[model samples]
Target: MKAILAFAPLFARLKGAMLLTLLLSLVTLAAGIGLLGLSGWFLTAAALSTLGSVFNIFAPSAGVRGLSFIRILARYGEKLSGHDMTLRLLSDLRAWLFARLFPLVPLARRFGRGDLVSRLLADVEALDTLFLVALGPISTAVLAGAAMTVVLALLLPGAAVIYAVLFFSAVLLVPVGLVLASRRAGAEVVAAGAALRQAVLDGIDGHQDLVLFGARDAAVASSDTAARRLSAARRRLGRNAALAGAMVQILAGGALVGALLVGFVALEAQQIDGPLLAGLLLAIIASFEASAMLVRSATRLAGAAAAADRLQAIATSAPGIAEPAAALPVPPGGEIRLEAVRFGYDPAHPVIDALSLAIRSGECVAITGPSGAGKSTIAQLLLRLVDPDAGVVRLNGADLRDVAGAELRRRIALMTQDAPVFLDTVRANLRIGRDGADDAALWQVLEAVQLADFVKALPGQLDAIVGEAGRTLSAGQARRICLARTLLSEADVIVFDEPTGGLDFEAESAFLVELPALTRGRTAIVITHAVVPASFDRVLELRAGRIAERAHVPA
Candidate 1:
């Protein structure tokens, strides 16, 4: 039920292979250890038995050679299985993260900058120790320590017990200390990255304004501050890494020192032969690697734990808009009406209050308003981009809340203020509203939007790459492509957030020819920042989140 334990089921998918590997390694380690103890006894016996060196060596030589062979096999098994388990856990983690992220981006964007990136990239990387470096080595170390203790007790009881106690303390201390050290760094890294992401976003979002105001220096300075914070966090994390290494060395040194003192006392008492004492010390040294690995794994796991926490929050986050299970049916004609609407993105920030308007099935309504007076919000509400806090948005007498979001969206095509051409071909961008639309359909919409000549002249024709965010195309050209997308939708309703923005004389003249064609036979709400089309059938003026004036004219 808890996140810490929740990862178990996902990781458990590879349990069989992991267990197989564990079994192989344990057997391998035990066999190798037995061989070491036996070889040590033989060496001592061979040395003591013969008066001359050559004859003494030959008697125990075969046993020592066979033991060495077993040790080699054990080492191979341990390395192989440990790595296999790590790979499995890594795959499970990556899959789990992606599944959580798919539906959460829209909600996560509202959470603020740097949070998601830290969780996804940095935190996920840290969590790798949950399995890779942690579980296997930790297990191996415990088993090896137990074996060493029993062997040590045979030679010297007090020394063996002390060694076991030191190991226990190191095991307990590793994960907790590493996590505490990394917690602040993980949080800081996320914060700094968020600042970095926001700075770039701000600059790109305001390219025109920044250029006009000559604020390049300010943008660069803000971006540099974000970069500096990121570097500082890295420096802090680097220190924690060094500390983790120091902890490992301390644990290893303690074990080695205890083993040496106890072996010396046993040799003096004649309680064990010389070869056996040497073998016990060597085995402890070999197995100390497990404890060292535990320390490293602990450090890595801390980062991952922080990341998983963020990702978990994102996956479970509820959406801003909730849709009903059963949708209310709207009439065939797509007449739209808003009634006594009070709405805003935030509870304290109602952008439109008590606003009401109605349009017939095929009439065009040009919504004109001062900036931030809710013209775009009206378009958003009608499209169900966001649901209203109070009041109703209706299509043909049916409430938007009762209509399935996907179904309602299908009946409408929106060209929004944030509309930018995708990094796709001209034909590809236009077909966004219409899947499986052929070349003929593409040409039809392009001609209507007065971009046919431009489309024809591009080297790749319809296949040309538009570049990132349609940078390859002029703003007016990009707008025309979006308008063309509306024609392909053939939806009952259309909302244009800003149709004539970023246009030149030639583009405006071209826009006039095709704009009406796109609006024909569609219930339309056109929001504009610039000139309102006088030819539209009706216009509503909004101020302070309410309709201030309405005028009707013949087309």
Candidate 2:
């Protein structure tokens, strides 16, 4: 409940729309009760008048028609307003979550892709019940119950107390009991659902590997376990709801019987007439309709509460990196220097221990070393994705920590070893580097990467939809597509990690030889185990977390 209440500010934003929805709901309920009560009275009065006194038939008939139309129109308006407010609230939630998600990049390390998707999609959707099923419906039920109690007091005083006790119990106590009993089951449902989603995603992503290893049955068994857990949790929640509904029905019957017993006494003493007594009893029955709605909504309240806790955790958890209170601008030049830097995933075993290096602006440098020798870590340090532990990384003599992350990234772009090509058009993928980049600019980079001919031959040319992760393209073509994207960036410095991956030896050598000319006038750092061409300005090797200068490069 504390977690749910933390979103009060978001709820406050749509207060006006929420109030409108509530008003329409009340109007709809009132019209329904009034229509039922008036019909009962009109029919009874007509039957009684046939024995003696003259009762006008015209007025009651007109009122029944009028109330029916009013009920229809109000019900329509209520549904329209309720759905509109709920959708707007959902939009706000997605926007809010995404805004926080950006600073938490490298989310792959901290969160599983399948789990993150579940939070962003299923958890957010569960919140839709907060307004439509829980708050709005509950509020309408209480208000309608109170109004009906007041009507009974005026017309059938002897039965007023009897109706109030049972009706309020059905609306309030029964639903509260259901929520408390199902809380654990609701959480189980959410956890099981997430596990099921993760299982399915893993199976799909590793289908080929599973087949090769003859482990398909193991994967299927894992998914089936998650499915069975989800089914059991749902069954428990449903059982609780069914019991609560039965309790409400029992109370409704008691309220009707109690009201009838007292009404007969009032009639014998001449305190109420036959027609009015009939109308009051019918109105009491009609009001229980609101109680039924409340019980149904109560079943979902528990799930919504659990979903709120998950969302709140995301909203309040500390970001991977904190921004400075007053960020300084990145300096102009692209001179990068690492001063006695130290860092490691585990502090006891450092990957880069007191390493220092320098590269002047417009210099093209290549650093080559064995795997797991901190080569890729250097790229991450330049991009400020991770900070050094013992020393400072500076840009133009300014500490990287002092500059804003967004500004630092704009100045220094990185093409990681496993850079992905999104499922989008060729033009769209390149535009990620520089939005609004024209056709000429895109074509220029494609030609530089030697992928222009293949792209031009495609049916959609620039508009073609590349399959997921560029599956439709060959391995080398996909690699070059990512290369083209990095080249499109306007940063002063660019770092390429294994840029020649997937290409033939001849193509790799050619690209490496032409790398300096392609990245002219920029500070380029190429991290690779491939042969470094003589065209580069400097070549250094990293070993044991320290730098060693290489005496020669391949001609």
Candidate 3:
């Protein structure tokens, strides 16, 4: 419940729309009760009236029609306002979650891809019904029940206490009991749903592997198990809700019976007429309409509560890195230095231990090493994705931690080994390097990467929408496209982690040969296992978590 309450601030932001929804719901429920009560009273009175008596049928009929119209209009408005607010809230939740999530990048280490996707889509969706079920219906039920009790109190005091007790018990006690009983099941349902989604995502992502390994049946079985778990959990939650609803019905019946008993005694004492008694009894039954709605929503409330807890966990988790409180400006020169830096998954087994290195501005340096030699860790350090446990990483003598991350990133662009080409136009993908870049610049970078001909031959040229992850493009083409994007960035420093990762031997040689001329004026650092060409200014080989050798080459 506390986790659910964590979203109170977001709810407050849309208070106006939510308030309107609640008001319309109250009006709708009230009008419904009044219509039922009046119809009963009007029919009975007309039946008991004399044949020639001045019975106002038109007045009662008009009142009934008016109440019906109000109910229809208010119900429509309630649904309209409620759904509008719901969509807006969902938008806000997604935006807020993304904003929180971006700062915590390298999320792969802590959260699985499928699990994060589930949180972003499924978990957020689970919270959309929070207000409609958890707040509005309960409020409507209480107010409607109170109004009916007051009417009973005035006309037949004997039944007032009976109605109030039974009504409150039905609305309040039953829902509370349902929530408590369904709490565990609701959490299970959410967990099972997330698991099912994860299973499906995993199967899709690994479908080719499954087919190649002849494990398709295993994957199908896994997905089936997840689906069955989700279904079973939902059944448990539904069962609890069904039982609670039955209890509410029993309470409603008891309230009606108690009212009848009191109404008879009051009629015997000449305190109430038969028609009036029928009207009050009918209104009492109608008032429980809100309670029925509340019971139905009570089950959803438990599910929503569980979802809120999951969302709150993500929202409240501390980011891996924190921005400096007072940021320093990046210096003009693109000199990068790592001094006695130490970092690793396990602190004792440092991947980069006491490793110190420095690169002057406008120099192109290539760092080469065997697999698991911590080549990529250096790239992460340069980008400040992870802070070192023991030393300082500086940009032009200013500590990387002293500058705003965004400012630092703008000055230093990195092309990671696994950089993805998103599902967008070729032009759109390149523009991410430098927004608003002209066509000539795009073509120049493409030409430098030897990809101009490939892109120009396409029907839409730069505007051609590529498939997701550049599936439409070959592996070498995708790698070059990413490399061109990095070359397009107007940064003082550009780091390429395996820039020619998927290229053939001939293409890789061509790219390496042109790397010097392409990044001639920037501080370029290339982390690769490829053969270092003579054109590079310097080369360093890493071994045993330290730079073991360095060689300088003349222009």
Candidate 4:
């Protein structure tokens, strides 16, 4: 409940629409009940007036017609307002969840790609039931029940008390009990659904690896087990909800019986006429129709609560990088310096210890080291993806922590070996680096990365679709496309983590030869295990998280 309440601000914005929905729902329920009660009373009165020959029929007949008309119109209005409010709420919720989750990409990925997808698409969607099923139905029941109770009290106080007691028991007590009974099963259903989705995704994504490793059977079995668990949990929750609905029906039936028994006594004592007695009995049955919604509402509330808890966990998790309270401006020059930086994935195994280095403005420097020598960590630190544990990283004497991350990233662009290639048009992918970049600017960057010819040969050229992760293109082509994207950025400093990793020796050498011209004005830092090219001004070797050797590369 607390997790769901976290979105109170979002709900507050839709309160007006929600209130209108509730009003229409109430009016719809009231009119429907009035129609039934009036019809029953009018029939009885007409029969009696035919025998007495002195009773008026015009007023009752007009009321029956008017209520029938209102019932249809109010029902239509209720559906319109309710659906409109729900759709708008769902749209806002998706956008809000995406905005909150986007910045926590590193942390989110730790939860597995399939798990994160389930949270984003499935878990977030489950919240729609929160309003449509739980809040709307439950609120309408309470308001309509109160109105019915007040109207009945005017005719017969005893019956009104009995109806109110039975109404609240079915609406509040029965639903509360059902929620408690199904809470654990509801949570299990949510977890099992997420697990099943993750298993399917894993099987699809890693089918090749599973086949190669002879683990395809194991993967299928795992997915089947998850599906079974999900089915079992859902069955249990359904059983509990069915039992609750049965109990609500019994309570509603009891209320109607009590109203009818009381109406008979009032008729015999002349406290109420036959027509009015018939109206009270019929209205009792009609009023309970709205209360019936609570039974279903209670069942769905448990699932919605579980979904809220899951979404809140990710939405509120602490970020890997903290934003500055008062951001400093980015420096004019891209002179990166690290002073005694220390970092580790865990305290027992440090990755970067007392690492100190500097790259002057507009100088191309290359850092070469064996695997796991903290070369890429330096790039991450420069880009402010993760802050150092103990020391300060500064850009032109301004501490990176003091500057806003977006501003810092704007000045320093990173192109990693496994840079993502989104399934979008070539133009769309490149424009990610510089939104609204002209075609000429895009072509220039593609030429610099040596991918212009390949793109031009494609059917759509600049508009060519790069399949998911650039699967449609060859490895070398995809890497170059990513490189072109990085080059399209207006950053003053560019860092490449193994820029030529995917290319053959000839292509690598060619790219290395063009590096100087590509990075002629901007400061460049290339982190790689490959041999350093003469295009760089200096080469530094890292060993055991410290700089072991430094050499000046001659022109």
- Ordering by lDDT: 3, 2, 4, 1
Candidate 3 Cα deviation (angstroms), residue 105 = 1.9
Local distance difference test, per candidate? 0.73, 0.87, 0.88, 0.84
- Runs off by more than 4 Å, candidate 1: 1-4, 7-109, 116-130, 133-162, 180-244, 266-283, 346-349, 420-432, 435-466, 499-502, 532-535, 548-555
Mind giving the per-residue lDDT tens digits that candidate 3 earns over 86-108? Answer: 99999988988889898888798
TM-score: the better of candidates 1 and 4: 4
- Candidate 1 vs candidate 4: the lDDT winner is 4
lDDT of each residue in 96-178, candidate 1, tens digit only: 88776654534444655445555655556655546546566567667877887887787667678877877665665664677
> Candidate 4: what lDDT?
0.84
Superposition TM-score, candidate 4 onto the true structure = 0.82
- Pick by TM-score: 2 or 4, better one: 2
TM-scores of the candidates are 0.73, 0.85, 0.85, 0.82
Count of clashes in candidate 3: 0
- How many clashes does the backbone of model 1 have? 3
User: What residue pairs clash in candidate 1, if any at all?
Assistant: 114-194, 126-304, 127-304
Candidate 3, run of 10 with poorest lDDT: 546-555
Clash numbers, per candidate:
3, 0, 0, 0
